[model samples]
Target: MPPRYSYWTIILNGTATSFRSATRDELIPTLYQLKKLDPKAVLKWFARGRLWESPSEARAAAQQRRSRTRTGAKETSRDRNWRPGGTHRDPKARTAERKKVTRGHRTNSERGRPKGGKVH
Candidate 1:
């Protein structure tokens, strides 16, 4: 028999899997069927002469592109949260607020030293 859809492809575990659907809405059901066959197998979608990470990702991208074209607006740039000169906080204040931990401290030179003198 001839294929129902004009273009559709599904891959699971590096092998092509058979599925029949006449509309894009079949993507979700196809994904679920693949999951049942092999939950841990790698899933992929081949459509529009391009490879996609998953069927859902391709659908989402298509929806997003449609919305953007409908609005006919360019994406706006965002301003940086920082200034060019330097950080807002003062270095001196940060050092003053820092605490020194001296409990159970032993320097490398002080370690393994005898009470008499240095060991030759």
Candidate 2:
């Protein structure tokens, strides 16, 4: 007889359909469910690379999303400038803002650390 489906398995299927992609957390629960259903099936899927997104593709997608979320030019001048109670009071504050915005999301280790630990 076929194994019974668990709640997590059902949730994962639903979420995957809605997102059109599965995050690690989303996949994990499904993996557990699959394991419970059939360990061999889980292993086979992994072997076929049906589990996770390619690292490069995932990174690019995240960057694209971040860029899309930034405030558009339609924002008021006050919104573009620092709020009275906010940080960044300096006239050159935009430089810092640009750096903060463009800075890679990953740390050195993630980007491949330098041999000497000094940033070029």
Candidate 3:
């Protein structure tokens, strides 16, 4: 059986084309071929919470999603030692750290008191 991974559908010259259990890597070349054969061919795939109308769009969204979720290669030593709101802060650097620190219930101290007494 072919890898049951990414699924795609293409409409070209009024003919609908699809494959069974085809992986993303397998379908990418087909997408390029279809595009070359007919520029009007529509490539559709389910990705990023919606149906993407083109392979390029799907690939860009997938790449962005991967970059957000994946870690390490983009990091520098400064990033590892950085803190939120600090002089060396880089928002993307300590995302997980910031999330961890902000998780769970917040206390009055953490929220900071008003200048005067409590509000009515």
How high is the CA lDDT of each candidate model? 0.61, 0.46, 0.63
Ranking by TM-score: 1, 3, 2
Encode model 2's per-residue lDDT on 13-119: one tens digit a residue. 32332222223456565566665765543311111223333545545665776676674543345645565655847657778778867974566677688756767
RMSD of 1: 15.6
Per-residue C-alpha lDDT of model 3 across residues 21-117, encoded as one tens digit per residue: 2345666677688789788876566544455665578899879868866864554445475665658666575787687688865655766866564
Best by lDDT: 3
The clash numbers for all candidates, in the given order, read 0, 0, 0
Model 1 misses residue 69 by how many Å?
0.7
In model 2, the worst 10-residue window by lDDT is: 41-50
Candidate 2: which stretches are off by over 4 Å?
Answer: 1-20, 43-120
- How many backbone clashes can be found in candidate 2? 0
Least accurate stretch of 10 residues (summed lDDT) in model 1?
99-108
Candidate closer to the true structure by lDDT (higher is better), 1 or 3:
3
lDDT value for candidate 2? 0.46
Put down candidate 1 lDDT per residue, 27-93, tens digits, no spaces.
6677777789788544455655555766677778889978997797667543554334577445566
* Model 3, C-alpha of 53: deviation from truth (Å): 3.7
Give candidate 1's error at residue 14 in angstroms. Answer: 9.8
